[model samples]
Target: MTVNGWQVSGYTHLRELGSGASGRVVLATHDATGTPTAIKYLVGDVGADASFRNAFRGEAELLATIDDPNVARLYEYVESAQGAAIVMELVNGVSLRQMLRANGPTDPESALYVLKGSLLGLHAAHSRGVVHRDYKPENVLVTAEGTSKLADFGIAMPVGREAGSSVTGTPRYMAPEQWTGQAATPASDIYAATAVFYECLTGRPPFEGQGIIVLRDQHASAPIPTDPAPPPVHDLLRSGMAKRPEERPQPAAAFLDILEATAVAAYGPEWEERGRRRLAERAALLALLFPFNDPAGGGTAVAETVLTESSGFGGPGAGTAGLGAPRGRRLGGAQKALVGGGLVALLVAGGFGLSYASLEGDPVESSKDTDAPVVTDTPSAPVDPTTADPTPPLPPTPTSVPTATPPAPTASVGDTPTTPGRTPTPSRTPTRSPSPSPSTSPPPPPDVSPPKIGRSAASPTVIEPGTCPYGARSSTISATAEDDRTPVEKLRVRFTYTLNGATNTVSMFPSRSGVFHGVLGNLPYPKVITRIPVRVEALDAAGNVGAGTVIYVTLNNYCTPG
Candidate 1:
């Protein structure tokens, strides 16, 4: 009822599609042209809420920009006298969620097919530099012909754009950095895609039984479900659902590749078409093996046709039409054996393949556990704790005092010396200082001076605003080193990107110091959030080159929750 009534004069609401906290969506038709579309109307006081309005406008703009075949296309966006409305392509089919409800978890082959199609759309969006902050089955639609498309970019943004005034993403699907109020990366998108895969294979998300914060905690600290998948889909889902973005496939295209490979391996080559054939063949065999008691039924009809065709009795030799006396029982017996054997073999092979594919590998090694410990070298000279940055300061005072000795008598043979060089030499014991254990201290051990090129606090990387946006064309980016080692004058970094079948590159430069720094300017627009693989390399005047930390990017809100 909330969806049927609308203020727009050009469109007539037909039925409810769905609703969320911000608005209600409905199926509608344009009055003049009679074209169908989905109309989303802002509900409540969202129009009065600046944060909400900004988010709504951002989403509308993103939807308007998408131009990919795999992504749901936005037709138009307009504000009617009643409220803001967005007209989107009306996908005439059920959400993947509904399908799952009606049919339980799908077979691995079917699931992968669905996932692959979705990734293609996502890649299109990523290529254009957009990230779909939210990606889930509810936003995925299957057409009457069974093609799948990704829907909704309500919270999507250009790669480096600052997030809106309000956090605009579904908590369940949000990445860890999102929850922690940190910027997201392409790896975040990889995490979300994998989450979808987990739900598809297990009929639920990877982490269950928790609120958003709890879920975030689970994402940040808990291990991905170590349990195996239902079948061949296991590898496909596991690889996509890796907790760390880097651990997952690099891009939607890569994800699709893995999904397709697994699906083909699981169901046998040409599994989709082959499955239909196998089903038909089995049905046909069943009819022959168990002919109906009544001559008018399916079993008898099938048997008679087979017998007539096999014996070349279609001509004059054909038996009388009405229940001719039963032909030799041998035909029934042989058919049963053949059909039974074939069915068993098919089942056995299918089970084996699925079991092999579904085997989840050992838990992945976590970065927290695997990263090289931070190395902090102590300054050669002791720094004053009060004036310094409140770190790496004075050593503790010695607690045990040396015992005092009595003055010695001078000019006596048995008297100890009391004057210079006569008193007991001060004990040469070196006092121990209270400080961080050797192993616990960061590089440049506590007592050692700072290294020639001091490492800065792992300053988190920054992605400038609008670099990645939802649903547009793709482009290339370059990153250069600007550290003590490579000065801006000598720095040169280049990289490439392909969108809608076009490719280009960006040039980057480093600063005076060697610490690598560069901005990957103006990425391509993406139809969905997608990941891009990037590698950075730095070189010295001597032609000696060093590799940089590998980082990945996605054009969407793919962040890990804090």
Candidate 2:
């Protein structure tokens, strides 16, 4: 099925995914059944090393024993004088590394779901007495359905892997014990899994550093980093990434129990479904990078602007991409755009609400998470435009409207000075007998009116190519809104927009001046001008909602920022 000197035998090659000095990985179809398979080859020096070949063969056999839905299946392992290759299931999805880069941080629900699937995969390996020593974001493949499959077990070793075995793993995700050259156990794998889970939730790994030694010291000494993630998972991170292996979750299933309970208590029962949907939407944004898109397409499984770790004990990065621990550059961060500390706005009366928190939509808000707000009136800088074109409701509230006579004419948004003076005459004429509430003195009918929103605008709708995902390249939405009973500052805003035929809900937080404002990013481009209809909705403290006008946003026909 292959030439004498071919890298792999018995499968036709479609394209190369990646390669290193040790070996190369390729997309191929099985000659017998034509099933898609990914074959990782060990060539030349490493392939011929007796120790490495034996290790590769042993792990391949261990992979064959794993039949869980979450772990990629190993089909066959072939060895010859030419080289050694392990054929595996070609996961038809992009890596988690790419997903975070394109869309930024995932919602809490989606992050939980991805972590759950990954833990399940790790559970399978752990149950079989195997440990995935390199469990980082790049090793987690997110399918179109948003489910994940753990891939690349090239460094996985059987439980109690000898201490003399070199300390090997992507340094960014290495466990404390791994840094100390200690034997790897299921708990070590759990530590790496937790670090990756943190990245999914907060858009960055727990620890990243410049060199392997710096990372090693941090892993051995740094307190677990979890504040950036939703609070519900803070305990989970602490338990899994505990500095000492004994302090971490013993088995992968034990961690799942804690994860499932926490997710339900914090996000409700439908959390997984909602999370998967959010993940699916974000993954779809990178459909072109999927290996199955075109077997012949020169596409790499990475985002347009690669995301990398800044500096921590364990961060996911550009290193150790393909299978095998080949001494890759495990320290380079992916340069992913940061998705925090941006402003937000809210939708008001008559329409749905939209508040901008971070560029990844609104800051994921939760009752337990008071640090970042979704739409509630959090005290921040003013964001709404005060482009003074007088609104229609102002003519009625003129300063000269207080009539001279004892006319208790109520002050309303639509009351004019001229009408207030005339209405006093009519009420007195009919009140010779004095009407219904003479004794009760009803405290002027309760404010039943909802808030009003006007002058909505989307600044710089037509953004230039290659300038986006940063300053001056993205669009900002601003609108004027006010309430009858609730202070305008207290109203919550939410904005909804359709992307790829699916409606996505975002937030528009208010500034200190009570104006709803938000910035819109993460939309794909390089196509002709398109019209996007954004829905607006607002909520006041009194539980009243009002409709707002739809705003249209456009994009350039061609050019995408790299």
Candidate 3:
């Protein structure tokens, strides 16, 4: 009844597609146009909650902005006293996830086609200066016609906009910079695409490990593994997943050019047609599970196609098992897997090992361990879909935390949140260049004093209780950084904080004279009301760095008890 009654004005509910901690997704059709659509409904506590409502609206607005053949379109978002829901074009097909689970590795041409379609979708988003932060196998949907479309922009954000999330992507496909908690960029999307392509070429992701720490190290520092990919496409894999952003192709379209050339040369110009045929064959195998397909007796019910033992992306017991969630959960296998999208907090040790902590009713689990076809968004509330923003489903923190063990110590490398950019001038020779002319004047003694940085604090250190998984309200972070030689304007102050396992760094521009300020908002919600470890560092023109001592910021995550 909740599914049928949830408001989305002109759409008629056909069936419930999926449901999870975020909410329920239903298969619906337009009353006027008779076009099939997918409606994502946020109900119960989530519907009444302001934080979830805002995130849902935000994502809806994001979806409305792009119009691309390769990306699913947003029809509308609805909100009323009844509930909030997102209306989107219903692609009549199975998710690449389903296909991958049904069939092992696709042929080379098929993998190339997958990469091309995903890249084009990313190209459209990148044209708008947006980055699809979480691009993985599950996010790519393939229709019966063999066409692929990008799904789940729930975690996409504009370029250069950084959310201090623990880490906001599927680790198997995450870019190197994402592992270091850097903002998403066009290159980041390309890296993820290539990683997915690798998965299609081989049966598994390019880099696989037990946890995020190992994955993080591999993504950020390990050699880009090109050995697994077919020898011909090895170059694409290397360039796309390059450790540095600059090393990868510039925009999504630019990489698309490279992919086109590679495919044509390796598999001939008709490669896409062949690939699509292969993909269509794979989709045919799971035709019964497709939302548009109704079995002989009745409509498709989740129970009918409940993922069997070998069918789950995570194998068995991905959802409530291991996770200390309220035991006796009665959700079907598909429901459990689809609902397993919450992010588990990762504790980073000095040795790049994982240290997990216990969570309450709201647990965090690695999504890869419990992936499903559709990603139900985060828990959200009501909004006037006619005008409200969109949503971000649970910060793509797609898993519940594991055991009750103590979290590992905060990483000590907070002074610099990003990998050092380029080697420092390749080390100049000791034989210094001839003295500059009288006008140059010895470069003013090379600005020896690093900018002095003061302690940093976010105004309301406590995150709002209601912002469960999306993020905290915008809080202003202020710190003073001044250099004896460099003017206040010349000094750059960066505030770094490590929550869960990821490090978030914010650049504080000159607010006025001696002080620097930056607005901090939408931090991934903390599992416990503990302290977030942070520090402030400043850079001067001379490349000297000054840092403040590590400080603790209290997070009062006061919420309703179960």
Candidate 4:
């Protein structure tokens, strides 16, 4: 809640730390010490709910009383009409969950370091009769030095026999008792911590499924996955994930002891020394391994060094090394002679066979006779027998035919004509061989028209941030273009902003309205009103250029470029 222009009464505001469905966290300076603190202010209905308000008070009291270095210290609690706010020590770190999402699962050594730190924090909270019901990666923060701090103790409950019946912790990290609507004890927190460990090893929580209901079943009944964790860590996760609270580690201190023991067992003197030695060895091994690791390193100096210096040869000699003897040496005198002789014999045989085939075939005579006149100009004539025999295959030697013939004998009107001494020709008509029919179908048409150029509509105009009065911090610039000849199927919009001598451009496309919107993120604009200059152009469907217009518009005081 806001009070006296400060979010929450106990501190003065500096900046917003974070906002969530639960509440907003703002960076503030403590009134007495002037030190930076994160004030979590829960406004509206959360202040009205007795249970939610009690949760904030309970967490504040627990954090204020604790002396753990890993826990966020609560300085004070404030109640006002705007909201209930808790002022706590500000943590300078990114969340472990964020790191995991960005970098994937951590290596075993890194995971162990984080787990050990979380265990230390949990142990301290447990000693003071407070249970961190939500012990997931999201609640763990890691500083620049890799130091981990367990955070988000706003829902932590005091140790007691009786408990409320509402479900609180994230279901994916919740224990079986939590899913079954049972009280969340220290054992429940232990189960949640083990869930985080499983996530670290597998890159996912142990009970991920289709939905919340399916996940609850998996967490409540499905077997904990067999992790590739070391033997000691495996046992710790197994003990912490037991189905029943009584069956699992009963206290957070017990869980912490197991984690500490596992860390000590895993981080042996040899392993620690090996890790350090590996860093030192990376420099030398960079020569032998780097080039091989990257195949594209061929043109690089590293590849040249590996091939030349490492192989005891220079440049081209390195390429030929160990590739066997020269080509001339590999082919001996006798084998070379045999290969040449065989090639010559093959060529001679092929030539002879081709010549014989050409002489034996009658292709020339067949083509010449294909359209020979059957009856000359008179439309009737005797067929030549020798020519009709398909130009009998040529003999070994060429021969010529005699062209001289006896004159035809004169005959009476009723007598048949015949050659001089030959008998009258028999009355008979020669049979004709079939001729191939010519096709009557027409050939396909050719395309000869010139291609037309395609023109696209100009992109939509960009809407500048600070042009609109509301929501100036998160604003968008838009641009649009339309074509008269053809419908605009695709639109492209570009946005450019100049800040501090550097110009940044962003491009976007909108599916509807042929418009494009460019969103500016976290950009602070001038707080005084000024004109924003923009360029706009349009192209028709036929690619004909339309009007190009430069526009200047007055923007909200906040949108002017700094």
Candidate 1: stretches off by over 4 Å: 1-6, 14-18, 44-49, 52-62, 80-82, 155-168, 183-186, 231-235, 272-562
- TM-scores for every predicted model: 0.44, 0.54, 0.50, 0.46
Local lDDT at 512 for model 3 = 20
Report lDDT (Cα) of residue 439, candidate 2: 68
Q: How accurate is candidate 4 locally (lDDT)?
A: 0.46
Instruction: Tell me model 2's lDDT, rounded to 2 decimals.
Output: 0.58
Q: Which candidate, 1 or 4, would have the higher lDDT against the true structure?
A: 4
Give one digit per residue, the lDDT tens place, for model 2 in 1-562: 3423554434578755555444466656544333344566655555666676666666666766676778866655655555556665544455675556444556789888988998899889887777777677766777655788887665432222234555667676788888667757788888888887887776557776656666778888988877777888899889989998889877788889999999999999999988887665554444433323332322222223223443221122213323343322221111111111011011121221111111111111111211111111111222333222335454564566556685455554444466444543232233255566656655777667887887787654544333342212345566767887776656777677775678987677654345566656546664566777776677776678875899887655554321
- By lDDT, the better pick of 2 and 4 is 2
For model 4, residues 1-562, the per-residue Cα lDDT tens digits are 3433435432467645344444455555434233334555554444445676655555555656665657655555555443455554433344554444323355556666666677778878877777777677657755433466676564532222223445556777888877666756778877887788777765567776766567778887898776555565788778889987888875666666766666667776344333323222211111111111112211211101122233221112112222122210010111111122221121211111100000011111111111000000011122322124435686687565656884554454466764487678444554576887987988754433222222222211222232322122232334555554334443223445554456666543332333443334333355555444444333333445433344443334442121
lDDT of 4 at 266: 77
Kindly report which residue stretches of model 2 are placed more than 4 angstroms away from their true locations once superposed: 1-4, 20-22, 43-48, 156-165, 291-562
lDDT of 1 by residue, 109-200 (tens): 55565667678888877776667676766666554335566766543322212334233355556566665655455556666766766766
Q: In candidate 1, residue 97 scores what lDDT? A: 49
